[model samples]
Target: MTTTTEPTARPRTHKRVPAAPNRARKNPTRKRGPGSYAVIAAVTVFVLAFLSPFAIILVNSFKTGADYRANGSLSLPEQWNWSVIGDVWERVEFTQKLINSIQISLGVVLIAVVLALFNAYAIGIGRVRWRTAFLVFFLGVNVLPQEGLVYPIYYLFKEMGLYDGKLGYTILVGITYSAFGTYLLSSVFSSFPKELIEAASLDGAGRWTILWRIVLPMSWPTLSVMCVFFFVWSWNEFLYPLVLLISNDNQTVPLGLSVLQGQYSSDPTSMSAAALLGVIPMIVFFLIFQRSLTRGLTAGAVK
Candidate 1:
């Protein structure tokens, strides 16, 4: 019995290791809190506040001059005269002016976007000498008041036989607007993944093919926003068009609106009607591309 007890087993030992670190779970679709709703409500109120004037103009446009003067701008129309819209259309040469605006705006947008994309690619994607200096020079050109350039541009274009018509106006506006577009698109191109371009090049894609197939498709949102910016700017531009286009046929909506004030300065209703009609196209255009505009502007923040 003593010998058996002496042979008792020794105690067993075990090694302990540290546990793995806890990983944080990610939430891609977290629910918004009450504060978010509050913010949305506040923004809605602010937007409504800002747009109230336009709303007033629209409402009063449908009313008689007396209705607005008597009941104030916010009041609904007591008597609707839809004919005022027609009257204004004729007076403003709505058809001609609208056509001019569309032609010039779309033309400027097209030219500017194309030029900006190419220039941006040259500066941002290409290995160019003094690219930074070129960019600075371009942006600096816009630093001075556009009004200051009116005289210089007027003389330059006049001598070059580029003034008076839609083509000339488009070219001028496109070139001027491209100053900003170049800066903007260059930044976008700079941000693009260099690896993609390298990979494409390795796959035997030419520069032209890469631009249309890859760059254009990928940067469509930003490009669309740029188009909108140019469109809005060209549409609202008064000074350049004024100086360049001497005749009524070549003028855009802003100038047409000015004519409205001059002719119907005494009649607020007709003026309002004309203004409302004048801006409808722009409003529609903005609404159509609102999503792309938002996405493009926020792209830098996103990635």
Candidate 2:
């Protein structure tokens, strides 16, 4: 007994545990190699190349026609002739054109978003019969060439006595644009959580109520993105406006800008000024809505 007790007390050794790794020391920051520097340089070159046109336009816009001709577009102006912008604006009736563009863009955004919401609601949330067929029809409409539809649209508008009018053009473009909006929003709404809708229904919410309260609020980000897209698309449209809006009073900014070009000869500085002016509104619009666009794009990636 005594020997056993003494043996138990003789030696009690503890096994050593290995220490945890120093994560920072083990995974040092990677040093940039030749490949990384090459990629960065390539990206910088591409960015500069893309921006060079805008830079040229801005620089030439400040020069007089004589100065522009003497030194070419790439050279700095001897003196900034700020009057070129004002002159171009007055020549093109730019204020009216700007107003027309705003009207058409806002109208298109409103009509397209509303119609798209209703159509997507019917197809996606309502689970309407032949939903696939409806989706396919929209896809067909989207892929259909605008050039081919021009003749038919022109004839139809003429018959309706709405040809060459801003109202008619807005309606046609809004409807045309809605096809895309519907297609895009339907896919989004189809994947929307049905639980929220079911719960709202259990609380006696009607379809209209559910759409207005639940669906619309949740889809605001996407709707905002669509609005911005529709605005830009409508603003930039050239072919339809050229064909339909014949009256100078009803002409959009693109049409106004086109008037600056002469078949035989045109003022380079004036054209540059007009180009700069034409681009500014879109740039402003983009800046204003950039946050919404970013939010909409990132929304799908999160909850």
Candidate 3:
């Protein structure tokens, strides 16, 4: 009894466990090699090269004709002439051109997106026969040069009485743009989750209902990106607008910018001003849809 009581009086000693070392703290700074620096330098140079034209346009826009001609487009303006923008604006009736551009771009985007959705739905989700052939046809349409079709399109539109007006041009551009949009969206839709489509079908959802409710909702990011691209493409269209639009009232911004140039000699400053102005709207549009574009681009990678 006395031995048992003495054994019970002894206190137990515990062994301590070592804590894990933080891998992050061991190597806080990452060492970049010469290749990294070279890549960075190369990217910087490319960016500067790409932006140089815009820089020249901006610098010359604020310069006088004499200053631009004498000191060159690369030189800084002798005086900051804010009036040049206003003068160029009035000369080109830029407000009307801007409105025309907005209308055409919006209209084309709507038509192209709708047509693309319909076409993509038929080819992609519907699992139609000859879908591969249809995709190939669309791809061929994209590759077909606008230069080759200009005459035919001009004649066709003229015959249809849709040649000169914004409505006609918008429709033409929308249809042209839809080919590429359809090709892009068809590829995206082809890879859509079959389970969702099947489930919807099992629940008595029709094609139209399934498309609007399930497909379209899930495809917003891609659709938004397509809309942005269509708007930009339509806005920057010079060839069709130049060919079809004869009246000053129906001209877009790119066509308006062309008015600033002469066959031989033109006001460099004024031309630069107009060019700078022309770029602003595109820049604004890009800025507005920048987030959507990013999402659409990364959606494939995320999946």
Order of candidate numbers by TM-score, starting with the best: 3, 2, 1
Worst 10 residues of 2 by lDDT: 1-10
Compose the digit string of candidate 2's lDDT tens values, residues 31-50: 99999999999999999999
Q: Write the number of the candidate with greater lDDT, choosing between 1 and 2.
A: 2
lDDT of each: 0.85, 0.93, 0.91
Which segments of model 1 are wrong by more than 4 Å? 1-44, 263-265, 298-303
Off by over 4 Å in 2: 1-27
> What clash pairs does model 1 have?
none
| Full candidate order by lDDT, most accurate first | 2, 3, 1
Residue 301, candidate 3: how far off, in angstroms?
Answer: 5.8
> Model 3: per-residue lDDT, tens digit, 1-303?
455544456677787778787667565677899999999999999999999999989998999877877888788888999999999999999999999999999999999999999999999989899999999999999999989999999999979988789999998889989999999999888899999989999999998899999999899989989998898889889899999998999999999889888898789889989999999988988888899999988887313
Each model's Cα RMSD: 8.2, 6.0, 3.5
Q: How accurate is candidate 1 locally (lDDT)?
A: 0.85
User: Which pairs clash in model 2?
Assistant: none
